[model samples]
Target chain A: MAALALPILALGALTACGAEEETGTPASDTTRTLKVGYISGTSLGPAFVADALGCYRDEGLTIEFEPIKNPADAIAFLATDKLDAYVGSPSAGMFNQVAKGAELKMVASLGSVNTPEGEAAPSGLFGAKSIKSVEELKGKRVALLGSVGSATSYLLGKSLEAGGLSFGDVELVTLGSSDMVPALKNGGVEAALLFAPETQKAIDQDVAHALVDSKKAYGSSTTAGIIFGTKLLKTERATGVSFLKANACAAKRFEGDWRKDAEIVKMLADFMKVPENTISGGGLYAFDSSLAINEGTLTEMQEMFVKVEGILTYTDLLPADKLVDDTLRAEAVGAA
Target chain B: MSPVTRDQEAVESTGTWRTIAPGPAELDPRGYARRRTLMERGLAILVPVALISLWQLLAGAGVLESNYFPPPSDIAASWADLLASGVYQESVLASLSRIVSGYLLGTSCAVALGMVIGSVRLLRVALEPTISALYTVPKLAILPLLLLIFGLGETSKILLVALTCFFVVLINTIDAVSSVSPRYHDVGRSCGASRWSTLVHITLPAALPQTLTGMRIASGLAVIVIVGAEFVAADAGLGFLVWNSWNLGVPEHMYVGIVSISLIGVIVGLVLRGVEWLLTPWNR
Candidate 1:
């Protein structure tokens, strides 16, 4: 008798769920929890600021930050609707996914290397003191955070290009950013493309010196940005806009050397579990308050990756429209 | 009926009745053995084929996402592509080179040291505990130090494989040598055998089976350790192939690397079994 009742109950529950789907009712904003993937550190400055300042709560959303070791994992999760949003660099992985018809997009630029004309960009190629120029890198090992398909690899190629060399000329070593400075010091690699505080560490330790500023090589460029998955892109776009609004609200705080702000520094330091000095000492990554996507830079990145054989599945470039949706960012910025 | 009656008469003569089943050898032994071997081979092939068919079905029906969980056919295509491109061949050769070099180096050193330590009481008492403690430490944990010491090259990865295989083979070799039968040693001594002669004829032969067993286990460990080390530290190898493909958002390529590694493991296991058979005749 109980077993018979159980099937009937289950049928009734499933019917109720089906009816809810049939009605096509929208979910409440307050009830929404956005799962955002992130790689920890200053790249996610705005998200951290947004979380700390309760911007997400104010916008009636709970932001669940999931730490990811690689952007590719986030891309996979995003395509499957496991992650609603992610903050990471634009990589060959993202482009390859788009080529494969995954419905994920770079909705907003998180940060860019917008260094002043005279100053060296904090993110660039740093090499051993004895070998001063990119030409010296010929036949020498140069490390990057990822392989030939990595975004940093593009930067390395550009730096190499300036010296009239190509990736084929040098041995490419894959090392984490933390390992870069040490590798340079210990001669594991002759040079490495390092980002801040690592770049700072290299200079301070007298191990390696900046050889090429990324700004001079590529001009003002978006290094990392926010991505939206199918769930946010098609199903619950309002929540996506709300997420961007919270992020944009926090981006206002990132204006003009945000590292100087004591509260921001403290919040970020606590969130990243690092000393306050580390936050203040590192070079600033610029975040646009409007949450704009640099279509030009995205084009450049795609072109660069497409040129490299076997890095991307498809050779043809994906138009900017397919890779990004500007409506969510526009809505978020308009609301602000 | 006639066989039952005859068996009953035999049982009555013996004053007891017992039912005994005939062994496979008694019931057409050659055919039985052939059937068993055929069944084993059939199941081995059938299970994986069934799994892959199920996977392809699910992927086709959209139960599994094609991008992340690519169909087996797609994986095969990607594997072929990699092969044609020379990436798969390069990766396999790299990993094989590391595994072979490290496995040979580690086992040779371990066996020599283990024999010496096992023979001398002072060395055994002084060193066994320390070696045991070191063995308990995770071999991969020292990879960072190896990288620091040896730099990020083939040396660190090769050494990591060696280190992992070393401990496993060392402990087993020590145990095998130390546990050789006392009667065998006495036989050699009573025959007026020299120390070297006893070691060669009596102790080594006694320990060879266990030592080979250790080597067999170390071969698998060598493959595992090298793959793991390659994931972090290498630009080429099966492990790197999997990692780089994933990084490149080519899941099919990643699957190819994974399948290749698994195939290598199976092949290595069979080769080791052959080695054990050749080395230990008495065990057979």
Candidate 2:
């Protein structure tokens, strides 16, 4: 008993030490470093552009980019104050955390379907050769690029509605973006909701074709964005505002035929570690220069998740004001 | 009377060995041992309970972040909710089905192959090195290839568990069969026993104990590998529940899944120990 109790007591002491570490030092007024968690994807083009163009440097901030596996992980890190901000999609995790009183808020939009003409959809549902349309996906396996509660599931849910089917109509399988195209090719899934480069890959491989265009399926929907944790939300609001200002500066470069810009493409390629052609060839996400968040999309996401069941803990939708804070983006927009 | 006084009186009075019936006060010879066993069991239960209570106290007092390490009460509530929803039962059943199928298939095949290789010098010389090489390859590393071959279904997860159990049981079985005394086989042969008779009567009983121990170890490995495979491959198992709950930002549900997995591991260990006891009575 003493043996077991000793280790447990040691663990308690370690936890107490961690609590002390969590009470981090205050940031200086002149310049502050923000620990940012992000996933490498085309949707985060603005951040890559910001880094390459020295937008963050201009704002008197040092940005540390930590690559994370999932937006959920980012949410957890942000809530725990391990990350100052996260560049990822707003998912059930974010909403649930906010509902549970985690001091975090989605401050800016990263990617949306609202774009000018002739640009490819940022993400869409692709079907195998045998599956030509969403209607053909009935009773078939449809793979999602992330977990069931991820932002991609919103796109998938909306796309399925076009065929008069719900998320329940087809079997939903969760797979990583890298595995999406292969799963489609191998009949592991009849269709899949693919993001950016993977969507381009499915078309290039000739194994799958577009079943639903995300842009057409849900117009002006913003699911991916920048979210601020407690540090940015409460303690260091100016730093958060400056972070958004930097993002707004980068978003200016994302306008009309941005992928055609070799420098921008090369910068993104270097940051994301993919080839230049891979960044240049694929559809780039539409980003708002002012970082205008779509609260309606967020509310709708919660409702859809609630309808799906087992994703959201609460039955009722969390109000939009509780989930988002537009003041940071508004300040940045005014500054820009 | 006190046991020490009774013993002294008997020794001084008799001066010779004599059997005496136990007195009423000393009716149960194992009373002290029984009390010791109960005390050990009580301590076993008490330690975990004490640790959990400490965790609850810390979490409730806001020292440990409730978001990350929720109080045990919250976890218990989530466990009850999951049970009421039947999600917990379904996840357990899914994982158990895969584990059982994989364990039986892997162990039976391993024992059969091990017996053949161990009994024959030429086969052992040809196969042991290759088997050893394959054994050293991590089972989880082959998951992607298994998914590719088995197509992201239950088959891949089951195969992963089977592969994990296979190597452990195979090595132990080969060693156990090989190390059976040559004198026992010699005695069987001199008594005009056939090859089958020598194997069944002499070699089988000698190797049974060690093989059962290997089987017990393999059972635990099977559970671990199946849970890991479920994390990547399957959509309805305990690993998926844990991952999904975490993704959904429900720490309570994740804890429920984790606790369920631990319980399953403990139950599997106990069940295997019972099987070992029943199968190898001589070891008992």
Which candidate wins on DockQ? 1
* Candidate 2 C-alpha lDDT tens digits along A1-336: 999999989986674454334434332333567899997777778976797899999887889999999788899999999999999888898888888889888899986766677767878888999987899888999998766788889989889988888888899887877888999998999999887778778888999988876677877788778988988887777678879999999988887778888988988989989899988888777777988998999988887889876899888788888889999899889967
Supply the TM-score for candidate 1: 0.92
Clashes of 1: 0
Second chain TM-score per prediction?
0.91, 0.88
- Worst 10-residue lDDT window, candidate 2 chain A: A19-28
**Model 2 global lDDT (CA atoms, 0 to 1):** 0.85
lDDT of 1 by residue, B1-284 (tens): 22223367768789876665676766799999899999999999999999999999999998999999999999999989998999889999999999998888898999999898878889999998999999888888888889889888788888888888888888888899999989999999999999999999988989988988888899988888888888888988999989989988999999998888888888988998998898778999
**Which digits, one per residue and each the tens of the lDDT, describe model 2 over residues B162-246?**
8888888888889999999999988998999999998888888899888888988999888888777777777888988988888
Which segments of model 1 are wrong by more than 4 Å?
A: A1-29, A116-120, B1-27
Instruction: Give the Å error, residue B62, model 2.
Output: 1.4
Each model's lDDT comes to 0.84, 0.85
Clashes found in each candidate (C-alpha, N, C closer than 3 A): 0, 0
Worst 10 residues of 1 chain A by lDDT: A22-31
What is each candidate's fraction of native interface contacts (fnat)?
0.74, 0.58
TM-scores of the models, in the given order?
0.92, 0.89
User: Which prediction has the highest lDDT against the true structure?
Assistant: 2
